[model samples]
Target: MIISHKNILVSGKHQKSIVTDVFYTNEIVQKPVVIFCHGYKGFKDWGAWDLVANAFAKAGFFFVKFNFSYNGGTVEQPIDFSDLDAFGHNNYIKELDDVESVLDWITTTHTEYTDFIDTTKITLIGHSRGGGIVLIKAAEDARVQKLITWASVSDYKNRFPKGADFEKWENSGVYYVKNGRTKQEMPHYFQFYTSFIENKERLTISRAAKKIKIPHLIIHGSEDPTVSIEEAQKLHAWNRNSHMLIVKEADHVFGTKHPWSQQYLPNALQKIITESVSFAIF
Candidate 1:
């Protein structure tokens, strides 16, 4: 039977709490650890993630996923954007620190769950913006044994605004982007760009990819409109030893969307789960 633990709080960047979830069997058998990081504007319970966790747990792996401390979700509400102020203040560095905190909790602090987690065989999986975070973390942390990214961005600097738009943001201090689903205007403070500039070297995904010595798997959807397939190719090009998989006709979310009502994983997402589980085991 799959044992699911939800909404466990962990200390995160700037003392903010990170909402976490863990899934595994009740067997207490040592299993390889898989930590998942959600992307920008993402939460732990987004879409079909709960189903994803159950899938991993059933496959004989201890799966963990968490929300970034400042992803705009509060402890009471771990889904959707509840606090835009916190979201505006969020930066890549904070997200990285949050991942580290989760790592520490799973490996050393969470004694109750540690019995089922193989500390030395931990793998980090990230989606979209999170893909970059896990890549950089895997490069810096020795605990991570394998790395996987889904629809990840190759370059962060390019994603930022340029010229007039950037100047406008700098002058205004913050910019707003409409959340198509929620119809909410999300704010991105100029500090976000400044923080990236300050930590440019450490946040470089290309450099991290080159530094990772463990097995790295890059997965992307060919039809992904949010992040192009070439980004995954770039990651592959940087790490020649890395393997890449392109899901033909799959979109950014792998045929899944917010408020995913289906009980089972989508066909494209199931393919990813199979590939990822195989990668972690072998």
Candidate 2:
């Protein structure tokens, strides 16, 4: 398999947006394509994603995993939290738009892979929060033939605290949450909540998952603390055609972390990647 990293200027929320993509392909002539979207605080090179991309490419698919425009990375520096302002200002609607932009660019603008890509067969894969984004995108975009989520959330509203304080948040200009690891205060402007509330009907994960007439797969870890296995069950329940698989003892990242090393993947993560490829093909 040949794996290469490149950058593309995608139409973003602002004037000019840059996205870094990890492209994977074997020497095969033309192959089905899978485009991956990372979750919050996730970039294209996060942990073992590159390895996963390679695995998919080796299995005879053209895989591309990209960093969201507002994912805190830049064209100059495609890794880490160098652009917190873009990260803080990001919202679900913008992400959905970004993914659409990427798809449009690949299918219409990118010429080198035009003959090598089977545009008719396109799949969108997302992890964690990104899973919700893909679900919504798939429901709305008929171009997406298959949808898959890794440790996906069934509902975006559940991420926030409920009740009358919702109005309190509306009045406040911004809300802050602590990153347990980085210890940096993450500021979610009131506009985030407002945008979500305004677009709730369009952004509902369950609604999107349920409406998906195409094949869907939900993969999660039984011991995942970040997103419970039940979330996977909920996604399956919402989409009767969807298949759910739970790894017995994998964590949120499937046993991978930042600055990860060692070539071999954890047993559970390998299973997740393998099963995802099988589902995509089947």
Which candidate gets the maximum TM-score versus the true structure? 1
Highest lDDT against the true fold, candidate: 1
lDDT against the true structure, per candidate, is 0.93, 0.82
* Candidate 1 per-residue lDDT over residues 12-111, each given as its tens digit: 7587899999999999789999999999889989999999999999999999999999999999999999999999999999999999999999888988
Prediction 1 global C-alpha lDDT = 0.93
Q: Candidate 2 residues 1-282, lDDT tens each?
A: 586766755676554385746465646477788999999878888888878888888877778877788776787888776777777787898889888888887788878777567778889999999999999999999889999899888888888756776666667766666766666677677777778889999988878878999999888988899988888988998888888888888888888887668787778889988898888883
lDDT of 1 at 20: 94
Name model 1 segments beyond 4 Å from true: none
TM-score of each: 0.99, 0.93
User: Against the true structure, candidate 2 has what lDDT?
Assistant: 0.82
What is the lDDT, from 0 to 100, of the residue 124 in candidate 2? 92
Model 2: how far residue 112 lies from native, Å: 1.0
